[model samples]
Target: MFIQKKYIINPHFMYMAGQFDRNAKLCTIVTELNRTFIVDKSPLEILNDSIRCIGFDLRGAMETAKFLLGNKYMCPIMVNPIHKICVFPDKSSIHNDVKWFNPVHIARTFSSNQQAMIEFTNGLIITVPMKLYSFNHKLQTADQFRKMMLSIEQDPFSFEKDPRKGA
Candidate 1:
């Protein structure tokens, strides 16, 4: 049995998009098995998974539609049926991608701070943060997240203290 878990860095945290920026929002990070996977799931897939895994029990599909189409919180980074990545850009960098879909419109459509959603080649849809947390700090921050990711990428068994016992 392959155990998978998701770790969300509540976008409300300042460290998500580097330092010296103020735009407290919630960011979600999906960590599964040895890989620190990002969220690339579609809005509809995320909604359904949230309901299925998190037991959201949304009122109904209509309510779900309303929720997704009512708020401009999460910004869609890239969307193509196969994969997508969204990010909540800081106020200064918001204008960088003006040609793509209107950030405001994307946000208004989904009542979530999530900014990215991607679908893996293996049929897994994921969502990820727009800007990754920087690699600096005494406390284990996203840098550690990156390290874990690299470690897994290099030698997945290295990080596992007890592979058989499953810690």
Candidate 2:
């Protein structure tokens, strides 16, 4: 366990959960490579800082997600598209309690007691207080967003042509 005044997200980052400490003070739990970082900032702030630290803006990422997927809310963001670093939130970032999870770091997810249980690649499991269906939907949405971004990056100008047409 360690305390960090500011955090820059990296490939090893697993998730960022906004939570209240023992004193009921707002803080964020950042998990990276099985290391815990108790950040004195909200999840949104941490995300924005990380993005900006890498020369990207939070709004640009959100807008891109929305434009690509037509998502109105809770859209996943690709913090660094070149590195394929994408993450999605279970709820609105402004919400007092929200968790931003990187899909790449997640090993699996299961439903139990109507809630969603996340299993990290490191074998850590934690239950989230949200409907399993909703959680799964969010995860799928994030996956979709990531795929779209990757496809675009791989061939932004390439287009599919029918062989029968003989282009």
TM-score for each candidate, following the candidate numbering:
0.19, 0.87
lDDT of 2 by residue, 1-167 (tens): 68888887888999889888888878899988768889988888887887897798999989877776664688999888767889998888778888899999889899898889999999989899898888889888888888888988899876344455443
- Residue 3 lDDT (model 2): 80
Q: How accurate is candidate 1 locally (lDDT)?
A: 0.29
Runs of candidate 2 exceeding 4 Å displacement = 21-25, 159-167
Question: Model 2 misses residue 82 by how many Å?
Answer: 2.6
How far residue 53's Cα lies from its native spot in candidate 1, in Å, is 20
Which residue pairs clash within candidate 2? Answer: none
Weakest lDDT window of 10 consecutive positions for candidate 1: 102-111
Strongest candidate by TM-score = 2
Off by more than 4 A, model 1: 1-140, 162-166
Query: What is the lDDT of every predicted structure here?
Result: 0.29, 0.85
- Maximum-lDDT candidate: 2
